[model samples]
Target: MAALPRQQHPDLLVGLETADDAGVYRLTPEIALIQTVDFFTPIVNDPYLFGQIAAANALSDVYAMGGKPLTAMNILCVSLKMVAKETLQAILTGGMDKIHEAGALLVGGHSVEDPELKYGLSVTGIVHPDRVLANSGARMGDALILTKPLGTGILATASKGRLATPEMEAGMAEVMRTLNRIPEDILIAGHIHAATDITGFGFFGHALEMARGSQVTMTLFASRIPILAAAREFALMGLIPAGSFANRRFCERHLQTAPGIDPLILDLLSDAQTNGGLLLAAAPQAAQGIVTRFQEEGCPAAALVGEITAPGKGIIRVEA
Candidate 1:
């Protein structure tokens, strides 16, 4: 995309320049549209669960931009000869359930027959023109909060290798299918400076983007970072995904780790996530409260993980 000619327009509030979660376009003086699309092959065994996770992941980009999803269209690729009709229906039904849960309509969609099975959504959302949050607005001294535990990639690897127990598989699925929506009142009260959802790019990979975009340095507290139960164990057992290694390599030049920092923890931090949580940069005074509210509202893993230290060229400093 960087090699292609870019399109320019006055109403294109957020576009290719910043690598933001979604594109925002002004529709009127008071409203802007948030649009994003995401799709992936099955990460979990259950087709219904995979559909739910895929839709949730796509819809999260809008929420990261402080917008509410209004409509969604499915994107599916599957082999009619290989996949059962009942399985296909279950996947569509699963996606629809999440769309309805988000108070969004599944108006239409397009599908094509393919050898590999894949599914996701194209979502459109709305936000007030002035209230749009971009990942580049994080201010120095802002408290960073991560809303979900990490390690989905490792868990998925374990499942594929037949090393994960049934209980572990269920737990991983629950994390992936959970939506990243924060209540309007909570967002308004927190005074968020910036936000982005953690997805294919591992936690540090996304954090580097935020740091670079905001022109600020992030000092992360490694001990405070949330990790899913068994993620560390699996990672230690060499269950890390290839994407994790790629993410770490991409960010290593700008990453600073304190002496004695646990390699295992670093592995977890670099784990590629699917349908992960929001990484919010909130006003220092309100950050703890935001975490509390998120926990009370069913995000049990939400916590204050770090803070913006100073203006810098997208450097991240990790302390144990």
Candidate 2:
């Protein structure tokens, strides 16, 4: 993508150049359109639950961009012979539930028969041109808050292999199904400097994007980072996913850490997540309030895990 020719249009406020979560294009003086699409194979066994997760994940980008989702088009890839008709219908129904929850209409969709089952949506949203938030606007001294705990990736891999307990599996599923709309709304009303949802890249990978985009450094307090309780055990038992290791490698060059941090903690920090929570960079005075609102709104694990530093080499400094 870096080598691709730049496509310049005056109304394009945010695009591929910044590694932003979504593309924002100005439609008028007061409105800008936010567009994004995402899909992946079923990570869980339940068709309905998988559908909800996929749809929520797709819609999260719009919220991360500080916009209100407007409409969505279903994207399904399934093999009729491999998947039951009822199962496919359940998946669609599950996706619709989340779309409706976001106050977005389901306009249309496309499907293709494939051996592996997959589902997601192409979501479109709108935001005021001046109010649009990009992942690149995190400023020095801003406090970073993560809306959910880490370890979804590790627990998910364990579940896929049938190594996870039913309780653990259910917990992870619920987390993935939860939407970021609440925190986005609260932070936007508070002091949102920049925002991004944690997804396949894991915590550090996404944070790296923010730090690099804003041309600043992010100092993370490892001890305060919330993590799924079972995830640590899974990591110790070697249940970490390939994506987690890949994310570590992807961001290691720019990651600086204090001495004596456990290796497993680092793994958790880079654990790739699914429909994960939003990472908000709020001003110092409003950071605590942002976390309070998240908890009051039902995100018990929300926390202030880090702070932004002056522009440097676009690095992340982890305090053990």
Q: How many backbone clashes does candidate 2 have?
A: 0
lDDT (10s digit) by residue, model 1, range 185-275: 9766648989999988899989988999999999999999999888988998999999998998888889899999997887889889998
TM-score of each: 0.98, 0.97
Supply the TM-score for candidate 1: 0.98
lDDT string, candidate 2, 102-130, tens digits: 89999999999899888999999998888
Model 2, position 83: C-alpha lDDT score: 86
- Cα lDDT for residue 137, model 2? 85
- The local distance difference test score of each candidate is 0.92, 0.91
Worst 10 residues of 1 by lDDT: 182-191
The CA lDDT at 20 in model 2 is 88
Clashing residue pairs, candidate 2? none
Question: In the order shown, what is each candidate's alpha-carbon RMSD?
Answer: 1.0, 1.3
Query: How large an RMSD does model 1 have?
Result: 1.0
